[model samples]
Target chain A: MAPLIGVVEFPGTNCERDVAHVLEILGGRAEILWHGESSVKGADAIVIPGGFAHGDYLRAGAIARFSPVMTAVAEFARGGGPVLGICNGFQVLTEAGLLPGALHKNSGLRFLCQEVALEVVGTDNIIGSRLEPGRVLHIPINHFEGSYVCSHDTLRNITESGQIVLRYVDNPNGSVGSIAAVANIEGNVVGMMPHPERASDVLLGSTDGIDVLGSLIDCLAGDTEPTPVDQGH
Target chain B: MRFDVKVEVRPRAGIADPEGATVGKALRALGFEGVGDSTTVHVGKLIEFDLEAPDVPTARDRVDAMCHTLLTNPVIEDYSFEVIPADSGSGD
Candidate 1:
């Protein structure tokens, strides 16, 4: 059976179809789960795609964290299921306490939409399992509030625990440690600001994103154990 | 009893407030001599809502919960609220 991936949709979410399309192209079944619904329908994996949920009012993802479906999503993540949050979804994960750190407005106070380079820093998580450390990939980021921030103590903890999964090559948003993505302590839940789904196709100017998404699919196929690319850090 | 609540939410101290800094820059650019270079600005949200509660204590408790749960994000923001009788005059 094809692995089923559930794409959650909030009121202002506009990336559900894009995510669903990409999953289907990757030979995985995708389902759109409405925010008003309380269940995830037994999905093999879940992807919370990017978009301006709740019009991004009161901060991005702040309002959407209370959606009925989020309860189930949290439950699914707590049970060790693979959950990927992209862009605004990343904000939602932090707002929901699934991930650490908070996303503030970009340091430049302007909306940034362009291709940015990312360095895979850790492969102990499901998202980076198939990629090599120090490898750079170009992915598009579009958001006004995408600067990740956390306390010094939290930063030290994340670094020591190998929870820092990806880092920005150029540090466009002034995130602490130039962090671009992170995984929860359990490593099953990952949240990133770049749109991997948008870059999965060759015609989209790059296919580098496929490796990340492919690793997710691989994890869903019962290959989720940590594969440390390099133990010297 | 009907009570009016005004909630003010702002980014916690030590966190960079880009929006507020932009506004401060704009103010300085407009030739506002009173705006000093050392001035720091913090931008936030003000939400006003009216609800029925038994008394002032209950209204404060409910509004505090509302702020914690939805009105403000505890991770990046701090919030405070003022509860008053709905029919009270604006002067008070």
Candidate 2:
């Protein structure tokens, strides 16, 4: 049976379907889960795609973090289920305290809408585990507030724990340590500023996202685990 | 009793505030007196509302809770608020 992947959609989220389309193309059953819905509908894995949830009113992902669906999502994540957050979804996870660090306005003070070069630094997370270390990926990042910031203590912790999943090759958005993605200690919940779904088709540009989403499917099928092999960064 | 509550939210001390830096630079370029080259300027938020509470402490406590939860992101921002009785004719 194909793995059932739940794509969560908050009110202002615009990338749910795009993420779902990519997952479906990768041989997983994609289901759209509304933010209002409290349950994940028995999904084997969950995804929070990017967009301005709750119109980013109080702050990006501030109000959306309180939505009922997030409660269920947190519960699923606590059980070690795989969860991925992209762009604005990453903001929500931080506001909800599911992930560490907060994303602030880009230092350039302008919205960036371009593809960036990323290097896989640590394979501690499910997505990074699927790809080889030091591999370069081209992903699109479209956001005004994509700069990542955290306390120095948190930075040291993430570095020592190997929770950093990805880093920018050129540090476009001022993310600390040039980090582009991160995961928890267990490597089950991961968040990234880039939009992997937007890189699905070769006609559009790149298809590097297939491997990222495919890794989630493999984890759901119990075909993969947290491999502690050092990437020797 | 009604209380007029005003809340101010700003980026934390060490957080990088590019918006603030940009405004400070613009002010310096415009030759504003007393606005030095290194003067710090920050753009923050102000929220005001009318609340019904029995006493000053009650109103203050309510607004404080709001600041801790919704009005500020503790990870990057800090907040302060003041509560004044609405009927004193100093609602500003």
Which prediction has the highest TM-score against the true structure?
Answer: 2
What's the lDDT for residue A120 in model 2? 89
lDDT of 1 by residue, B2-86 (tens): 9988999988877888878778888888888777542378789899988899899999999988887877777678888899898
Candidate 1 stretches greater than 4 Å from native: A223-233, B36-39, B88-92
Candidate 2 backbone collisions, by pair: none
Model 2 per-residue lDDT tens digits across residues A1-233: 67788999989999999999888777677999999998999998899999989999989999998999999999999999888999998999888888999999998899999999899877878786478888999988999988899999999999999988889999887888998899988999999999988887887687777667767766766643432221110
- List DockQ for all candidates: 0.74, 0.84
lDDT of 1 by residue, A1-233 (tens): 67888999998999899888877776677999999988899898989989998898888998999999999999999999899999999999999999999898898887999999999998888787679999999989988888999988899999999999999999998898999999999899999999988887778887777788878877776643333221110
What is the alpha-carbon lDDT for the whole of candidate 2?
Answer: 0.86
- Candidate 1 chain A worst ten-residue window by lDDT: A224-233
For candidate 1, report its TM-score. Answer: 0.93
Q: Among these predicted structures, which one has the highest DockQ?
A: 2
